[model samples]
Target: MVGAEESGRLVTVGRRFEVVRNRPLLTLAVGHMTVDMYAGLLPMMYPLLAGKFALDLKTVGMVALAYGAGSSLSQPLFGWLADRHGTRYIGLALSWTAITFALLGFVPNFAVLVALAALSGIGSGAYHPMGALNASAVISEARRNSAMSIYTTGGTLGIATGPLIGVLTLGAFGLHGTIFMLIPGLLIAVVLLFEMRAIALRPRRTGGSPRLVPPPVPIGPISVVVGVMMLRAWSVFGLQAFIPIWYASMGYEPSFYGLLATTLVLANVIGAIGAGHLADRFGRRILIVGSTILSVPALLLFAQFPGSIAFVTAAAIGLLAASTTPLLLVTAQQLMVGRAGMASGLVLGLGFVMGAIGVPILGAVGDAHGIQNAMRLLALIAAASASVAAFLPSEELVRQFANRNSNALPAASLPTASS
Candidate 1:
């Protein structure tokens, strides 16, 4: 039988664990779904909006960049908010942000539309870190990677499905006709936001407890992980930006492109789960580096062959490229100890910015040079970023930190080493 003192310690630790993540994982999952669904609406609107404004490729790229900017720029503020008030407020804010974007589709002017697009992006910025915080609160060290992989796949699916939505809406509504379609998504968001209220009044358990979490992992290793994500994002965003054009030019029907995209997204769903499990058994750093290295060849090969082979290669590239996402994030979180929000934001905010910037750069390149050149450059990013992942230390930094902390190691001695 356990002694009282040991039992008390267990209770304290259990309670702290409870408070950190007493909320349902489903809640976090639903939150991810709601926020990401906003991205699904973008591609559907892009063609219609471009025709309406008589915009060129560059202008349209700028419009896409505007949304990315909102998603990027708002990270620090949301990260800080998550750090302070907990993620519920951030989640609530993001939900409303989605609602605004839904309505923003109704506005007419191009400039106003851009502004609303940015605002909508800002709202979306909250979903990731906020959802991550909630997930981390509940996820123990063992299952975090898998849970995150599952959650992130939602975003990939939304992005993949967006073009279909846009096409269908165009067929039905004729450009602006789909503006009203956003209302239902907005209403869904409002309903989900209500769940936050219960999560808030639940109770706090982390206060005044003996520190049981491990030592902080090194920022350098985490930075390396973030760098890998930047490259992955670049490749994903670049292809996503131009693939529809490429497919059309290849003499494929829109339906064929749609089917190809759906296959790629499905590959992502499988890749994320498989990668998470791989990260668990082998190591995060190894999986990240390996995925990166393999993806480069896959992407380059795909670029060289732009028809059926490219479709097959794109799925292979996507699987390897996206597999690293959760591992990178999990590495960052371990590095930060209790600070899931900031660690997550650092990668996501920075990577998304890099990816967003890549859109305009590649757009201009596609205009000036050609789409092939744009794709080639993105493949380079995949290679370079993956090479960097080799340097990140993986071996359960959380355990490393917690082990060191238990020993009451000197502050100067505990330098957040990941190995």
Candidate 2:
């Protein structure tokens, strides 16, 4: 009876460890989705809010800027902190995100609204690097790309759902309905706290936590990768900025605009999920460059054509152009293995900041020439980004170098004669 009981105990123990290993990514992914839903909430509600406050377009843009600055600009600091310490506050960050967004409905004026938006942004920013770092840590390098893709898909889907959720809830209950948003955030926070504890307590295979020590990656190659990401961000932000306005100007209904937005984001989600698998199977570089190159023609189709063909081309652009994001993220992480948190932040945070900056600039260009011309410029920028992507070393080369360094570690750590 004692032996049988011991065997059963062992089986239970094994199952628990398995759950500990795998469940955090799933939890963080859900957390990511829940928090990012708020990111889209403000934009969706902007029309209603503008009417309520009698604000102009420029004033509305300020609210977005406030949110963008808080959420994006502060990512590097949060990421660095996550790397230096750990993801202890990830749950707190997400919970705060919920609180802030829920309060957005109650703000008395534009200033308070901007402040809450910033707080919401900060909350959103705090989770990303920490969640991404934790996700990478939870999986082996071989499966990292696929795992990250799965993780990212959750957030992308969340953002896509945000607009629909906003329209339904706000339309029904007005601004005060945001109070209902608290439920999901609170639920996810509890899940994250419990799961993160379990993962933390799970025994490390190496018998110790791996301390953050800088890895050696060439500055030139990584710089090129960062540049490519920034350029891609510009195009992404530009499309997102102009698509609705362009459609409205052409006399399309709100429903049509929503469809376009949905198609683009859903296509992006599909691309993000699929591209990761392709990156793992084929080389990362090929998928990155090929996708970017293909997206240009889709943009051209979008520009040159009209009607249903434009919608099809928009989906194509989304599928091909935006699909490479996960691949870029994985590449950055690989290049800086020890600093995965920082890499994630740089790719996500910094890239988005550049995109935000491009919005006004693109608007200016649109004013001077035309919105269509501005979009053409975006296509050109994407092509230029692809050209930059060509500079990245082959995947095999990076992997071989990493393997060589790993193999030499034992020798390097061996005790000297004096010791």
Candidate 3:
């Protein structure tokens, strides 16, 4: 009887231990979701913004460009700061984004809306690297790919929900519905601040005295990865920016188009999580190359077919195109060894900036030619991304290189990828 009681207590203790261990990752993941939810809102709101402001496609694309530039351009700087000082301001960053984004609906003029979007983007920029760094720091080495997928999926899921929320709020309450969005971000921000404090006090997984300077980055491989990522982002972001407008032009109602956008993003979430596990077991390069190649056909199909058939193609595009995100993130972190934060920022920021820049270019094409042609161009971009992805090193090579660099660096100069 006593033995049975002891066993029960042990099981309970083990369960408690597991939950405590996972708490930080969960908190950061939720934070990622909340921050990205704001990003998702923009595309859904674009059609409304256009109608309200009497803007053309190119001008509407500028709104995305403004947000993307602010978010993407500032990431590396914020990442560098996070590495030096530690991620102390993550909650504050989330709160800032929440406040700025909530005000987006209330803006009286196009200029004010654009300016506020950029301001909101800065807050997202601040949160990303800090959140990503902490997410990486919390997990075990063997589980990095899977763990990152979970983290990335949080953001993806938030993005998936964004269109739904936008359709509901904007449909029912007009623009003022944005005010309600502030609640979740603020609540999550508070939770992160409390949870992360405990994590901050814990001993770091990386041993040895901290180094003041990080080692040199592998520019060649990183450049290749960035190139592929940029092309992929261009396709993904371009599709996201234009999907609603295209559907609207076809006479689809806001609810139908919004649901389609949600389906696409939700498919991305599924693909990201599944690909992460696959990459962990199989290899990153194969999945990256394969997915990019497959996305070309998916994009072409979506562009060629409209109506009911479009949903199927959009899901395929989402599944194939965005699936590589977590894989690329893990690969970049593995390559950079000690400078995970900086590498993450560089990869994510540059890719996003390219996507941002591509939106306006694609919009110009749409203005001059047609939106369908612009989408076909995304297929070409995906083909280009596949070509670049072919050049990426295998996961085994990246691991060996990361290991070699870690051996050369002074202890704790940067967190080792393996650590």
Question: Every model's Cα RMSD, please?
Answer: 7.0, 7.3, 4.7
Candidate 3 on 155-178: residue-level lDDT in tens? 988888888888988888888889
Candidate achieving the largest TM-score = 3
CA deviation > 4 Å runs, candidate 3: 1-21, 200-211, 415-419
Better of 2 and 3 by lDDT: 3
List, residue by residue over 74-112, the lDDT tens digit for candidate 1: 775676567556654545555556556656556777898
User: What's model 3's lDDT at 376?
Assistant: 93
Candidate 2 has a TM-score of 0.83
How are the candidates ranked when ordered by lDDT, highest leading?
A: 3, 2, 1
lDDT of each: 0.67, 0.73, 0.84
After best superposition, candidate 2 residue 359: deviation in angstroms? Answer: 2.2
Clashing pairs in 1: 20-137, 21-137, 21-138, 44-166, 214-401, 214-402, 215-401, 215-402, 218-416
The clash number for model 3 is 1
